[model samples]
Target: MASFRVKGGLKLKGEIIPQGAKNEALQVICAVLLSPEDITIDKIPDIRDVNKLIELLSDMGVTVRKNGPESYTFNAAAIDLDFLETQDFLDKASALRGSVMILGPLLARFGTGKLSKPGGDKIGRRRMDTHFTGFQKLGATFRYDKKKEIYHIDGSDLRGCYMLLDEASVTGTANIIMAAVMAKGKTTIYNAACEPYIQQLCGMLNRMGAKISGVGSNLLQIEGVGYLAGTTHTLLPDMIEIGSFIGLAAMTQSEITIKQVQADKLGIIPEIFRRMGIKLDIIGDDIHVPSQKHYEIETFIDGSILTIADAIWPGFTPDLLSIVLVTATQAKGTVLVHQKMFESRLFFVDKLIDMGAQIILCDPHRATVIGLDRKYPLRGIRMTSPDIRAGVALLIAAMSAEGTSVIDNVEQIDRGYQFIDKRLNALGASIERID
Candidate 1:
């Protein structure tokens, strides 16, 4: 029940390096269960969710050794399969949504996997049908125990098959790929999620001797292998954090340099911020966001209002829409933010509204923000963080507001961003963690 007391109206300067991708770390860490050899991973973000997954792995008898501050070597040589059925395992696995991924590798290698109902941000209804459905398509028997709220999967004779996914779910696709890699034949997955995280997972699987093609597209082809070897993988910089920093710079009128952001992989994020008139300079791998008093939102060619919507990869990411909505509050014009994936994510706008930002929560899925244009600076107020993204969004709004703001439930923010208050404080912003 910690809180953040943020002093507003501070101009941040200096450089901040984005941490390793949180999403990718979850998938690849679960992939360690696919092999019993040593797998060294670098650039791991020290965050709550990722650390929970790592702790889950350690509890499952995976030999986890810290090589450095951001590196670990995992060897799943002597996994205790009986642990999955224990109450302790259920308690730990139920707390992390990423724990669902472990079922795939366990089923692939040991032919049995059990998972308690996974938990994560309460943004909306995140169905597990995609993950289980993909497993069933790959010859796994699925059963849900309603009394205990646990999922049971057994795949003794897995074979390759072609299937069209009902939705392009990133974690679903990753889970299925991990299962299919050790199947008997080739598997083709259409309408798959091709985000950088998935691509990185596929690339790591390839390096580990699994055959996968179509790295950056919706269609993925995998040839089953008998066993996978160990390999080293370095995760990409978290794009969500980079986008948040960009929004923080614009909202607070600060000049900040984000170092080694792997800009090429940040599809449409930069342009989407630029559409809101945020100036970004891409020098090598770093993104330089300059200070600006006012940035104007761009409209369509036919004179319609600018719409920033989320899509699959190569489109705007839904994770950053919260940041966009908060950033647009201080812009020169209006922008419509459409958060299509999650229904309840835009609910945080009510907090920003309390901070003196003009926002119309049209519905659960869309919000229209009329920029105050610095004529009316937002005045800080007490608020509560709803989710990871929204929490960061509120932090940004508080940083650009006129007074001190107390944000409760900052644990939600820490789940994604590693030491966010400390990092931003180094850039000259004032954020104090109150325990």
Candidate 2:
């Protein structure tokens, strides 16, 4: 496994061109199954999850070719659906939760899909009940063999129906929408996840001649078409990475500019950072964070203690909350971070506490951070990465600390971030990849 050894107390300064959004790229690549012609996607991140999906597609007889570093051409016209039942296919499909997205398109186009249980960060109990229930509502039958962990789906023609998801799951909504795009009638999905990734999926589907409305809202209307054509599309910038860079610049007291941020897609990310007294200037599509001595946490409206919490769409992303919590440790105030989405996500704060940060882990889901405000820079320490977001959070914490630190289990970081070490190096971070 690869590890990162970072020398701390370095002020990172330079411009970083963010890579494509991993979430969007996953869904977009899976959409290729809906067409018989070649589909070219530009700016796709070369991350582990994407590569796994590419391997899965290739195993199913889909022709996948990498035309460039971040570009791919997919031709799924000759895919063999029978491979979905193999053990090798199941092993690859279980690597990431995003693998379940292929189910919708495969079932829609070929009338059958077999997949194993999907695996991802063990944050909480991620249920596929919503996905199966939605598919059943749209004229599909589901059969599960628990012993084998294989799910079999079959249907003659998908018929549109009104679907109210149990929860606004990001991948579940994408799956349902992909199935609905080629159904027999109109599918109205209420309480849909309308995050930027979903918005981009909807836009791409529209470009491919699928009629979809309510692109950026909780309600989506999709008119089923007989067939979808292939089209070239460029992905949006990674907003989560942008938020991570913002936290890195703030904690390290660095002046950095993030290029091609797609400010229109950052719903309330900037405002959330502003609450922590982090100033950001948007130069066109670029986000610039100026160097500062320290940051102050803003309190609530009645001068009471403030708390930052995450919710569904239109609210703060739970993925970025870890970075926010770590960033608050070096700020000038106290704030309670409530990560309601995942129970085990807040457990990483113990590592920060080991590094001399004053953190009160209330429970499995909450933590109270008392900022040092430059009184004490976090001292270097050895830590293990728990997951993708927490791994990046630890990297930021290590970069802002004094002396040296070692981070083990970097595979978790590589699963999501594309060429993270190279990107951070461009920003002048003193980090080296050691195997």
Candidate 3:
């Protein structure tokens, strides 16, 4: 196992480029299975999750070749559906949440799919009922083997149908769209996730000859086509990573510029950060965080304490709530953070509290953070990463703390951020990789 030893109290300076969106890349790679020709994807992140998904695809007989750094050519014309039932495939599929996306394309093209229970951060119970319910609406039958923890889906000639999902799940929305794209008729999905990742999936499918409307709205309409052609696509920049960088700059009192940031795609993120008294300058496609003069939490309209929370697309992302919470610890005032989507995500505040942060965990979904305002910067301390978002949050806290801090089980962080230590080092962050 590898770990990160960071000496905090150093300001990060210079420019850093954000990596490709990991969530979007995973869905896009699986979409390749819908086409017979070669599909090339550029700007793919070199992270463990992406690597694991690629390995699963290769095991299914998809031809995945590295064309260049962060580029790949995939041909799923020879995919073997039988491989989906193997023990090796089950083990890998159960390791990442993104693996559930392959179910739609596999079922669409081959009429059946067998998958294990998908795994990811243990923040909450992310049910697949929405996914299966949507599939059932389109003429798919599901059989569950509780003892073996396997899901068997069987369908013939999926016909388009209107589906109203219980919630706006990002991966679940992507899966429904993939299955609907090759169905027999028109399919309408309500309460669909319209995040940038979902938008990118729709755009990529459109380029490959699938007709999908309402790209950035909660309602999606997909016109079924007999076949989709192979196409080349590039992924959007990782908004989560971009948010992390913003928090990093704020906490460390650094002035760093991010290149190629899709400013418009980051809906309400900058404005939310602005509420924390963090000023950002957007020069064209770049985001510049100037050196901090002061960090103060702005009050709400009624002069009440501001509360920041996460929601579906066009709202703040749940994935970045941890980073936001950590950044707020160094601000000048108090803010309420509500993480309604996940229960265990807010539990990581215990580590920050140990580092001299003033936080009150009100419940599983809420916390009150009183900032130290640079008067008492966090003291360096050792901690273990429990999950991906928490790992990044702890890293940001460690970077802004005094002295040295060690973060163990860094592989969790590696699953999301690509070359995090190297990228932060380029911006003058004193973080070293240790084994």
Which number leads on TM-score? Answer: 1
Clashes of each: 0, 0, 0
Give the TM-score (vs. native) of candidate 3.
0.99
Decreasing lDDT order of the candidates: 1, 3, 2
Q: Give all TM-scores, in the order shown.
A: 0.99, 0.98, 0.99
Worst 10 residues of 2 by lDDT: 79-88
RMSD vs true structure, all candidates: 0.7, 1.0, 0.9
The per-residue C-alpha lDDT of model 1 at residue 282 equals: 99
Query: lDDT value for candidate 3?
Result: 0.92
Candidate with more favorable, higher lDDT: 1 or 2: 1
Residues 1-435, model 1: lDDT tens digits: 999999999999999999999999999999999999999999999999999999999999999999999999999999998898799999999999999999889988888899999999999999988888888999999888999998888899888999899999999999999999998899999999999999999999999999999989999999999999999999999999999999999999999999999989998999999999999999999999999988999999998999999998878888999999999999989899999999998999999899889999999999999998999999989999999999999999999999999999999999999999999999999999999
Clash pairs, model 2 backbone: none
Show model 1 residue runs off by greater than 4 Å.
none
lDDT for each candidate structure: 0.95, 0.91, 0.92
Clashes of 2: 0
